[model samples]
Target: MKAREAVSRVLPATIACLVACAKPQGGGPPRVEIRPSDCAIPSQPLLRGIHSIVAERAMSCAVLDQGQVACWGVQDLGRLGDGFEVKRRDLPTRVPGLQGVVAVTQGNDATFARMADGSVRVWGPNRGGEFGDGSPDYHIAWAPRAVAQWGTIKQIAGGIPTCAIRSDDKVVCAGRARFRRMNEDTAAPGGTPVVVPGLESAAGIAAGSGFTCALLGEGSVWCWGMADAGQLGNGGGEDQDKPVHVRSLDPAVEIDAGSDTACARLAGGGVRCWGRSFAGYGLDHPEKWLRPVEIKGTRDATQISIGDRVGCALLRDSTVACWGESSYDGQLGDGSDETRGTVAGPVACVRDAVQVSVGDNHSCALLRDGTARCWGSGTYGAVGDGTHEIRKIPVAVLDAVEPAPDAERCPPGTTFKRGKGQDDLEAVAEWCETPDGKREGMYVGRWATGQKLQQGGYVSGVRHGEWTRYYEHGEVVSKDRYEHGEPHGVWIAYSLHWRFAFASCFDHGRRVWQVSSEAEANQKRCP
Candidate 1:
């Protein structure tokens, strides 16, 4: 059967069978309801053999096991590394003719894998030469093809572009040269890989959203690509197509990149960051840091991973600390939705966190004991817990296995955090709160500044009057006369203790008259 037909014919029955087989241990089966009526399918005998694999968002993911690799998600650009841009496959599918695979890396729309023999295979989104096959068009490599020019490949990284280092300590990259374009007179299309100049003996490489960096044997760093956001770490806004030394970075051991920033781990077990600070991913300051700024007071950093808007560091003590945009589902793990402009406090998700990976909207931490925990946006099953639920706290992802004839049902207090595409505000809010009342006052919604509160004005927090004035700093400037939080009469404002600044008459929060006085007019103009 065709892929779509096969999915349509198989999905309903598989869901029903799985639902029916799941019964609470020590009790009768709980109520199971399949809704939307039209999409329902009856259980069939053949469906019993099928199983479903759940993921958070279908980006690009790969798993390496026993020298073999399997990948899935968004293959429109051939990112699945399956040798063809057929379509998206929701489940993990093995790449044809690939074996002895040891490691795999994914880009926004491309994929690359390395073999035990030190050979590399690339496939999927080739819009830029991210595939390193010297082609501009997306090429699906169904089988492992030897990169004849690159030998003894030791490490590889991917982003909007792709880069890899050979065992002999040479570096190469492919994709749009965002940093290089900043200096060149011509627009360079992303396709065709290029050699990064000035680094003849590099030991490692890391790629960001639009840039790439490398670590040399001498403990220095070089980077290139989109520096518009200062991702190149050169302490300047100019983009560098060729590799240039990153200023103020020393004793560097490892590096990682985000959508618009990069982080490096020093030999002393400390961490430093450069690039966009809008989400606090960069160092705290008014000016963009071109040089590395040591993360204040952190001295045990062992590993680091950069996300689209957040960056996380793993300490030698096995503790994890994250900062940067914590607004979207608390991906920063600060126990609040407030956007942190710097590395806040460390989080206590698990002990002995041996590995970590940061996605665009979520993060994953792997325990030394083989258990994995994830947090952030679950709109696309990115949390991989069998449901589309946004989780402010970490949730466990159960390994996929065939359902038993009598499986246990979901436990009490267990509720699926509805996916992002699904509308369920209550569920989303509940997940954003900490068990202890820490995040109670926070609300994740929209607001319009400088707008008058109407009769039916909505406020997430406390509001004492209908015509409340606010300072430019988001603080409550003053409260006007009110009757049950609705404006009733003339209101006056004062700057200091007895110094009247402004006066205004209002009818139910709508301004009606302003006193013709200099002080009142000045307050209205400034406040």
Candidate 2:
């Protein structure tokens, strides 16, 4: 069965169990009857150097213990930064020889990473000089090469093309001048690196699927490139080949972009989103918010990350909330597989969430405790548990570093209260019925002992033919042949409970029935 279908079936039962357990009269959380082997707690040696991170476009990413980065996904033109022209890498491998990386950014197939020295390196498909190497050839740089034109880079952003900002405040870009095409006059003279016109002292840059935006030191925003989806936040559908001011935004500290949407976080910790509502990342309400629409109910948002189908915000309280499509897997972390168009209910897997990142079908959060947990699709081991098992809850990737031990044996007679008893007696009775009449003719005792209570072929309250009595614990308490509910023929009795009160055979409904001399049974009288 498909994972979604399987989850749908199992989730209802699981939810029922949870709801039943939460009731005041009901018991606490149901005991999970998992075997020791099923827990699979790993040894510490296997957890060394495992770094879990998120990337765009369902891409595969790897982060070294020292923070080096490499990624591969949707590389139609070698944009996956693997120094290859292949379509995609189904497996993850290290990027040849790159080190001392602090952060990474990706756009389509091209990738850029910032190093410890504040230098930036880029590779992959560079048809428009988006590789930042002053070349437009579609060649893969197998080794990390420095972008000499831009230095002291604090942050980097890439769209259809690539752009970066230096610590000194200047913005430089390399790639086709598609953003200039919005004016119709400066339609890119082929592919070349050009300084974005008008902007100086940029504090940050954000790149969408096709457009780019920059947060300036003056507390204003500017955008360029594809505007078909209003991703530029310029309140117009026309593309901007050159940088144009986005007057709608206030002084912003951080900005994020998805396939066709852009959002910014204000200094006051309020968030405003624009572009591509159809993708469900723009705003909860309809009407195509060309300008910034304040994200409802989100306050103290310190960090934000946007994906093609979802968005997540890290709050100052160290909590993370997400919204948008969660169908691909547990990407939303709302404890449901259904897609959500609005903000998700809060989740509390960790105490102090420090960093959050969203992928096409997965998400990861770094906690203040230096631990990282991930959820969503694990088809590519994106959850980083060393296994590809998909989880709907945030699972510690480092928790299971070693293989599970052998399965342990359990003693017999282990009875577990699976869940609450339904008030529907008919349903409960039907559950105790067996194919043959063997278990029928049993009476319900004062206490439930897991025994099946069933009636055999009977008329009124009288029992006839073979009649059996069961121990409340599901064991046979006695077996007797009866005529009209009165014991007849051979009768046997057992003990453990009720001490086998009586064992006798009777004619009709009364008279001295043949009685067993068993110590416990003969000591009591029959009713």
Candidate 3:
């Protein structure tokens, strides 16, 4: 099953877990639509010095060299962990209040940040007890919160129900227990994290929408959860409520699970996959495999990732080869969108690729240079570019480093012009104003879709008057005053629903006061 289809199937249960919450925010840029395509920037790089990369349904995040976490794409339900108020960012924004983050992963709309200290922090939609916070309430976790008192976590994987590997090599899971993947016939109250019975000394674990798999210390593999798609690889179509060993597969090193399929890297550098065989197990004809089957045309595969329908392998030569459902969104990254094929080939412009991650419609590759690139579906910023446009080839994920000299060059109304300090990363050589070469006036920028995306007054390339950010749907998301490029006076952030989320006062560049969803307090403070 495709990840999108899996999401829709699980949506009802997710929505049932949600609860209302207060809002919070402050004004900054023009509002983009909260929709999949509206909130992205155009052709931007998102992260730098990336040590690891993780991809979810339509979002991607990375862990930097120093354990800092950055994520972009699909900020709904606070999945990005930047904050709840941010709809989406095409470029990666560092997840706040975290350090020493060794790894990251995601469920449908949630993120798990694993710290070096062996503790885990989780955020985003808490539906079906995926947050593992021992709470039954459904809500968006605007920030990373501790997963109750659990700690000593070594590895973590996210899914409809997230799972983790503790220091003792025991596996623990939290989330919906419908498939009994949690190993207990009856789920613990409040989705508390619990040990998977009789499972220990595991080397790695992978979580899927409704299943989990583990690579044991002895190089054996075990799986549980819904096996209707043959994902369990136990030579049967029946579901297993507890971990069951698969015959004829041992010495496995790594494993990954998709919506309805799973893949493993063997001790000999080959990859084998089973489940929803239409996705391809290296055969000319799409057929389901009840047991592990080697993916043809692949060898020396150091790493592998499975998308909803597509799959990719990172060969030892640092190139990527993708197959299955390649046309769904250029997920194959071969420059053309072919509907579906069993033939795996090299991805365009992907070299020195150390790690690869595949999402529902897109995929990303982390290079040895510590930079990241993505291709395929960009709708929802899945490609990590700043726009909703689809990419036919790899594009750099905007990094925090200095942008290219031309990056600041704005279009028409906000065109970039030569100016002093133009080379400085903080310099805004571009200004927003009348298009007739006018220097002193307000400027407006509009999208090709014909909606105004930005409007603010400027003087000599510097903002110097009232600025308001609007949502792509025409609702105002923020209002603030600026004095010569610096924020001043009242700053307000509005939720996508047009509700007051946060209010703040800025003097020059420093904040005077801030309140979370307390519009009255902000009004009085600003007044």
* Number of the top-ranking candidate, with lDDT as the measure: 3
- Candidate 2 lDDT, 208-269, residue by residue in tens: 66677888986788888778877777788897777777765677877777777777888866
Worst 10 residues of 1 by lDDT: 1-10
**What TM-score would each prediction reach against the true structure?**
0.59, 0.60, 0.69
For candidate 2, give the lDDT of residue 278.
26
Off by over 4 Å in 1: 1-62, 70-78, 81-98, 140-149, 178-192, 278-287, 402-527
What's the residue-level lDDT of 185 in candidate 2?
41
Write the residue-wise lDDT of candidate 1 on 1-527 in tens digits.
00000000111221110111122122322223322331222232111211111121244243433444444334444444443323343333445445566666666555566677777766554565666665656544433455554456777776667777777677766665434543344444445444566788887787777678888998898887767877777778887767778867687887877667778888867778888763433343443556666664356777777776767776777656666666667675534565544543454344556556666777766554444456677653555454456666555544332221111111123321211111211111111222332221211111111122232221221111111232212233333323212233554433323233335454533344544344565455311
Cα lDDT of model 3 by residue, 446-518, tens digit = 1001112224211122222222232312333332232311245665544324454445465643445655455
What's the lDDT of the predicted structure labeled candidate 1?
0.50
Q: What order do you get sorting by lDDT, best first?
A: 3, 2, 1
**Superposed model 2: Cα runs more than 4 Å off:** 1-54, 60-67, 70-96, 180-192, 278-287, 387-390, 398-527
lDDT preference between candidates 1 and 3, better one: 3
Q: lDDT for every model?
A: 0.50, 0.51, 0.61
